[model samples]
Target: MPDALETMKTLIEEINKHNYAYYTLDQPSLTDAEYDALYDKLVQLEAETGTVLPYSPTQRVGGELLKGFEPHRHLARLWSLDKAQNHDDLMAWHTRAQKLVNDYNTQHPDDPLPPLSFVVELKFDGLTLNLTYDRGELVQAATRGNGVVGEGILANVKTIRSVPLRIPYTDGIIEVQGEGIMNLSVLVAYNATAAEPLKNARNAAAGALRNLNPKVTAERKLNAYFYNIGYADSLQFQNHQEMVEFLRDNQFKISPFVKFVDSIDAVEEELEKLVAMRNTLDFLIDGLVVKITDMRTREVLGYTDKFPRWAVAYKFEAEEAVTTLLDVSWNVGRTGKVTPLARVEAVDIGGVTVQNCTLNNMDDIERKNLKFGLGSLVYIRRSNDVIPEILGKVTEEADGSEIVPPAVCPSCGHDLEKKGPHLFCTNKVGCRPQLVGRIAHFASRDAMDIETFSEKTAEQLYDSLDVRDPSDLYYLTFDDLIKLERFGTKKAENLIAAFEKSKQPDLASFLYALGIPNTGKTTTKELAEHYRSLEKLMQAEPEELITLPDIGGIVAESIVGFFRDPAMQRSIERLLAAGIQPVSEEAPAIVDESSPFFGKTVVLTGTLTIMGRDEAAKKLEKLGAKVTGSVSKKTDIVIAGENAGSKLTKAQELGIRIIDNEEELQQLLGDV
Candidate 1:
C-alpha cells in the first residue's frame, strides 16, 4: 500500500491537473464523476493523515467565518492610471508622452531610449486583486486597496477554481495583479435560482471578493483575468508582450482583447474597433488602458503623484439613448426655487430604466434648444453610473411643441418670479411642498434626531395641524397627534417625546436643519465649528464666511442673504424662544489637539447596536470631528458598524482608518 502522504500528493496533483484543464482551458479531461472520485479520495487521505497542505484543494472547501479582513501590505504599489475622456484628451496624453520621450532622448544622445510603442487592453469593470505566490505556492491574495495595503481575502480567492494553487515557477516570489469578475453568463444562471438576484455583474464580483465568508464567495463562481506582473524577486519581463506571454504560460487568464501598436493613429483605430465590439464581450469593460510596452520606457517616464506617466486609461463616453420628450413638469423646492423636471419616454441606458431627466432652468432649456424639444426625440446620457442628464434635442428643426414656463407656482398658485436663470416661487409662507420638505429635513436623523418621523408624518402635520415651519413641530401637542389618522396613544406619546428630546441639539445639526439654500452639511459644520454659537453664525459676514475651506463666493452670499431675511430671523427667534437650545462647540476639552478623532473627517456606515449613528455623529462633532455621508479621500476615519457595505468597502480600498468594532469606538468616544 502507498503511504498516506504520498497517496494524498498523487490525488492532489491529479485533481489539480483536471481542475486546470477544466477551469483554465475550458476543457475537462475527466467526467464529473471521475473528478469527484479523485477529489473525494484526496479528502479521505487528508482526513486520515490529519494534515492538509497549503496548496491542497480541500482548503478551498472553506471553514469558519472570519471576524474581519486583515490588511495585507503589498510588496509593490498598484498605481492608478490617469484617464482621457475623449479623442482630444487621448491625443493630449499622446502628445505629452512623445514630448517627454523626445526631451529624454535629447539629454541622452549617446544611449537613447527605444521609440514609444503602446499596448492597449480592456479595462475590466470589476474589483482589483493582487495575488502573491512564493515557491510555486499561492501564498496570499488581497484586494488592490490603496495599492499599498489591502484587505487579505486569500480564503475567499481560493474558492475560485481558475486561480491556480500551485504554479510551475518555484524559483522566487511574484505578485500578480488582475481584475476579479463574475461572467455575465454565470450571473444569469445564478440569478435564475437566487432568492435575491444580483443587479449587475460588476457589483456581484466585487461583493463576492469583499464578503467575509469564503463559502459565499465560492458560490459566485467568479473568474479573473491577470494582465500585469506587479512584483517579482527573480523574474522580470522586458516588455508588455513578454509579460503577457509569461502570464499566459503560467496558466493565468489573459484577456484576448489586447492590441499592440507603434503609432498613435493605430491606437486610435484600435480604440474605435473596441468601442464597436465592447458590448459583445461576456464581461464588463468601461474603458481601455494604454500602457507603454517597453519596461525601460516606463521606468524612464516614471510616475506622477497619483498615476504612472507611461499609462493612461481612455474612458469611453457615457452610454447614450434617444427618447421622446413627453412633457415638462415644474416643481418647487424647500427654498421656493422652482425647477423643471423633463419627463421622457421610458428608455434604457446601460441596463437602467430612465424616464426623468433634469433641465436646469430657462437658461439651460434655451441653451440646449430643449424648449422646442417637447414631444421630440432628445439625447439623454448616463455617465459614471449616475442619474441620466439630457444632452439636448437630436435634430436641429423645432419639430415639436415648445415647453412653456410656469406662470404660477404649482403648489401655491403664487406668481413665479424670475431670479437670474431660475424661477422662484415667492410664496414661502404658503407653499405646501416647501413646508413639507422643510419639515422633513428638520426632523431628519442628521438634523434633529426626531425618531419615527417620516415624510407622511410631515405631510399630515402640514394639512391637519397647519404646520408651516419646522419650529411648529416643537409645539405639536400629544393631543393633536392622538387625533390624527393612524396615530395610536403610544405613537402620539413617542412623537411628542421625540420632539421634546430634539429641543436640545448641537449647533451644527441646528444649522443644517434650517436648510440653507447653498450650504451643505460640511458648510454647516464648518460654520458651527468656527462660530460655535447660532447667534455668532447669524452675525457672520460674507468676508468671514468666504475664508473657510470649500466656501465659494456664491455660498458666502447665500449665508449672508439667508441671515438678513427678517422672516428667517423671526423663525430662528421663535425656535429659540420655544426652548430649543443648540449646544455650542465652545468647550476646551473638545478642541484638544492630541485626540485622534479631533479635527478629523469621519463617516458612519451600517447599523450600530450601542447607539444610533446620528448619536455617534453628534458625539464625533462635539470632539471637533466633521461627520459626512460618503467615503472619499478626504475622509480621515470610518466608523464601520455591523453589516457595513459599499462605504466600508470604499474605505478599505482607499486604506482609510476603519473602526469596525463598537467597543473600540466606545473606547475612543469614551476617552474624549
Candidate 2:
C-alpha cells in the first residue's frame, strides 16, 4: 500500500495536471464526478496525513495572469458593441435605422429597397482571435488584443485540434475573424468537477485562451467559429450569408444559429425564436447580432468609430417573469439521479412561452424557497442555456409551505436516497424508464442502429413478450414479434433483419449501445480502439482505464459496475451467443519484399469504393502491405476515403503522408 504522504503528493500532481488540462487547455482529463472524487480524496489525504505540497492543486487556480501583449494593428479594425439596454431601446434603434433606410428608398424607390437583407448571428461571449493564411497555409494567428496589436500565438493556436493549421479553403490568401469559445458541454463538465467551479463559459474561455503554456491551451479543446472575412483579396462573396457559408465549406466551424432575414419584422421574429430555443442549445449566447446581408449595402452603411452601422445586437431581457407554479415533479434520468421539474402555467417572457423549467437540485429549491402547492407565484430565468432556474418567490404562497423532497421517484415510484445535492432512485436494474431509455439509446443511429426496433415496439416487446431489458431483445422470436399489435409478417421480419444486422456491428458501436454512465460515443470508440476486443475491455483494470484520455474514476467505475452486474454479464454473454461480433483492429498485412508497400503500414478510414474496408484490408494483406483502420506512429501512409473524419487530421498531425484516391493507393502499391 502507498504511504499517506506519497498518496497525497501523487494526487496533488494529478489534480494540478487536470487543472492545466481544463482551465488552460479546455480538455478535461476527468469527468465531473471523477474530478470531485479525486479532489475529495486529496482533501481527505491532506487532512489525515498533514503532508500538503506547496504547489497543491487545492491551493490556487493553475494559470497566471499575463503581464502584457505587444499590440499589432489589424488589417480591418475589430470593434466592440454599443448595447441597446432594453427592448424599447432596441425598438427605438430599429425605428431610427428604418427611417434612414426609408428616406434612402424614398429618394431612390427605383433602387429596389437598397437590397436590404440582414443575417443574424448569436453574440458568443468568448475571446476573439484573427487568423491569417497565405496560399492555404496558416501563417500567423493573433488574439484581438485590444483590437490593435495582438500577441502572435501561431504556435499555441496550432495546438487547437479544431483550428486548422493550414486553411482548408481553396482561396489563395485570406484573413478570417472568429470567436474562440469554450464549449458549453466542456464548461459544464469542467465546472461540475472543479473545487472552485467556473462562473460562466466566457470566463472559462478567456482563461483558457490566455494561458502562457501552449500545451494548456491545446488541451482546453477551444473551438473557433469564423464570423467574418477580415481581409481577403481576389475573393468576393455576394452577401454576408454567402461569406459565412464559404467559411464553413472551408472546414471552419461556423455558428449553426445564423439565419438570413429579409426584413426587420423577420429579424425580430427570428430573434424571438432564438430566445425561445435558447434553453435547448449547448452554448453561451448573449443575444442576436443582426448584420445587413448585402455586401454593397454593408459597404454603403460602413462603420461608426467603434461599432458597425449596418449591424446591431438585439439583447435578450434579463430574467424577471411571474408564472403560477403547478406541482413540482421529480424525474429519474438514465443516470439514476432524480431531477426536480417545476410544472407551471405557461407565461410569456421576453416574447417566449415557458411552462416548465428545471430545478437543478434540492439546494436550488431551498435557495428559491420553492413550495409545491399550486397557485404559488415564482420567478424563472435561464442563466445562459445551462438550465432554466427558479430565481425567487414572486409572492408569499397563498398556501405557502416549503416543498419537500419526494419520498419516491415520480417516474417509477421507487424509494429515493440522497446522494449529495442529488436525489437518486437506486432501482438500477429494475427501473422501467431506464430500461426504455437504454433500449432506445442502443438502437439510436449512432449506436447499433437497429432502425426497425422503434421505441413503441420496444415498449410493446417489454410488456407483451416479457422482454424488459436490452438482453431480452436477442431472445425475441419472430412469432412473439408477429403477435404484437400492428405487427405483420413483414414488420416482424424487418425487426429480425435489423437485429441480425446489429450482430455484426463494430466494437465502438457495440460499446456505445451499452449505455454505460459517463461513457459517451467518443470514449467508447477510444476504449474499443485501445482494447481491440470486448473481452479485453470487460477485463480492463481501473488503473489501465484511468490512463486513457477522457476516461477517469467515474467512467472506470461505471465500466466496472456494468461488468460486475451478473445480469449485465449474462446479457453480454447472450448477445455474443446471438452472433454479435465486436470489431478488432486489423492486423498488419505481410508484405512480400517484392511488393511496392512491403514495409508500409497503410491505414484507412471512411467509405472506400475500390473495395470495402475489410476487403481492402484483405487485398492490402495480399499485396504484402499492412492495413490498419486508424492512424498512429506505425502508420506509414493513410489512404483517405470519402467523408473521412478526424483520423485524416491525426495522420497529418503525425506527419504521415495522405493519399486521396484508390488510383493513388494503387500507385503506392506499384512503388515497390
Candidate 3:
C-alpha cells in the first residue's frame, strides 16, 4: 500500500515532530519510551492502512464521545478585558489610556501614533482558549462563547498538549487566543493521586475544558499559552513585539511573559513585580495584562460593550470568598483520621480573617457540594497559608443541612471506621487524642528531641503521670518530673535532660520518632538507608519494601503495620526497656564535592531555630543534601524557617535556592 502510505506519512510527521518537541520545545528528542514507539507505529499503521490522516498523530487521541457541542462562529471578536481593581483602579486605567493617546495624536498629525508602548501580559488564571488554524491544520476549538459564538471544543482542545497540532502559519485562516492552564505544579501532582480532588486550578482549567469527555479532557493534563492572534487570515502585526515574534514563529505555546513597558510608571512597576512574582508561579496568575503596544494604538483605543478598551485586567486581591457555611467540625487526628472541619462565617480572605475551612474527608464533603454546605453561601479558597478550602455551594439551593458523620471518637469514645475517603479511629491503644497526638509527635523538633516536650507537656504527663505511651516518656522521674503541674526546679532538670538526649537516636532519628503512618523524614531516611536495623526494619518485605527507593504500597503498609502491632510491639518493648539505643544507619555518604549542600535538592521550610529540622535533616544528609517533602520543579535548596509557609511560597515559585539565613544556615551546616 505504497509502503503503507509511506509508513503512515512518516508516522504522521514524526508524531507531530515529537509533539512539537515535547509540548513546544521543552526539548525532548524522543523518550517516553521513544515517544511510545513512534506512537505505537502510528497506531499500527492506522489500524493497517485504513488510513486516518486528518493530520493524524493518531488524531490526538480523542474522538468517540461528543454528542453535544457544535456552534463555532469566531473568525474574530473575543474581547473581554477591562478590570483594574486598585491603585485607584490603575490610575483610572492609566487616565483612560493617556486620553486615547492624546486624542489620536491630536487628529492624526500626518498619520502619527507611535510612542504609546505597553504590552505586560500575565493575567492567566485559565480557560478562554479559541484556536481555529485552518490552513496550518488545527481547525477549530472554541469556548469564549458570548464573544461572537463558541462551544465547538474541537475534541476538548485536542487534549491540549500545548495545543499546536500543525502550524507554521500556513498562509491563511488563524484565530489563536489561549489561556487553558491547570499547572499549579500540575495541580499539585494531580492532587497527589487524586480520587476526586481537583478543587480549583481555575476550576480545574474550567472543568477540564468544559468536558463532554475528551477522555475527561485527556485526564486534565492541559496546558496552553498562545497570546492572541485572534483571527488572522493573512496576518498583520505592527507591534506587541511583532505579535510575540509571530507567536514565536508559529510553533505557538508563547508565555515567556513579554514585558515592553513605557509608563503608567512602568505599568505600576510591572504590577508590583507581578504581585511579587505571583508567589513563585506554577501558573494561576489572575492579574496583570495591561496591553496596547501599538497595533495602531490598539485601533484607536477600541471597544466597550463588554471590555477591551485596549486591555486592562490588573485584578488580584481576592483569593476567593463568598463565606457563611458556618458549621461542620469533626476533627480527631493522630492518624485515627476523621477530619472535616468547616466552621466558616468570618470571611475576609485575601487579607486573612477566614475562620477555619478544610472540609477534606467524607469524600471531601461529598465532592465539595459540601453535602449540604451547612447554612450555604460557601466558596472559600485562600491558598497561601493553606488551611482555607471549602470551594462549593453558592446557591444550587441544596438549602443546606446534612454534614452529619460522627458515631463516636470525637476525642476518644472510639468506633469510627470508613477508610476510603477517610474516617478511621480504631483507637490505637485508647485515644485521648491519640495519646496527646502521640506525645506531641514524640517530643517533636523532628521527634524524640524531647526537651520540655509540650502539647501542654503532653497534657500534664497525660493527667499527672499516667503518661500513656511514647513508652511512658521513658518511665519518668526526678519524682516523675517533680510532680508535674508546671514543674520547676529548672523544669525538673530540663525534662530530665531531654530524656537523656533522646537516648542515642540516629536510625533515621529512630524511624522519624515512630509516628510512621506513611513515614516522612524522607521516608525515614529511605527507611534508615534501606533497613540498616531495628532488626532490619522489623524484617521488612512488601516485596522487599517495594524494592527500597522510598518504599511504597502505602509506605509498605505503614511499615508492615507498624511492626505487627502488639500495640506497636509493646511500644517497641517499652522503648527497649527505657534505654532506647537506635544508632544503625551508616553507609551512603561519600559525597563531599566541596560541600555547601553538594548534590543539592533540599527543601526544609519554616521553623528551624538554629538546628533540629531533624538536626537540619541530619546536617543535610551529611552535606550531600536531597531532603525533599514537597515544593517541586525538582527543588534545589530551600531551607527557610521560622514561619516560612507554603514551602516558602513554593521556593519563590520554583526559581528555588532560598536559605533564609539562620546565619546562612549555620554557615551551610559547616560543623554539624
Predicted structure with the largest TM-score when compared to the true one: 1
- Cα deviation in Å at residue 354, candidate 3? 13
Q: Which residue runs of candidate 1 sit more than 4 Å off their true CA positions?
A: 322-379, 384-387, 390-672
The residue pairs in collision within model 3 are 280-653, 606-641, 607-642
lDDT of 1 by residue, 1-672 (tens): 258888888888888888888887888898999988999888887777788988898887666786556679999999998899888778877776776678678988997889989999999988999999999899899998777888899998998888888988889999989999999889989999999988778889999988978898989999988899999999887899999988888888788889999988899999999989987888888789999899988887777557887999998789899999999999988888999999899886654468899889989998998878888999999885566889989999989999889899988999989989999998878889998999999999789868768898999999999998888888888899899997878778888988888998999999999999888788888788778888888898999887555577899999999999988998898899899999975654564556678888888997554565767887887787867777877788999975578999999999999999888898888754
Report the Cα RMSD per candidate: 14.9, 29.2, 21.1
Please report how far candidate 1 places residue 456 from its true position, in Å: 23
lDDT of 3 at 591: 45
The global Cα lDDT (0 to 1) of model 1 is 0.86
Model 2, 65-127: lDDT tens per residue?
A: 333333456766677765664566566556645555665677667783454677888887677
Whole-model alpha-carbon lDDT for candidate 3? 0.77
What lDDT would candidate 2 get against the real structure?
0.71
Whole-model Cα lDDT of every candidate shown, in order: 0.86, 0.71, 0.77
Compared with the true structure, what per-residue lDDT tens digits does model 3 show for residues 102-218? 766787788878776787888787778888888898878888877887788888788787787777778888888988888777777888998987765777888878877787777
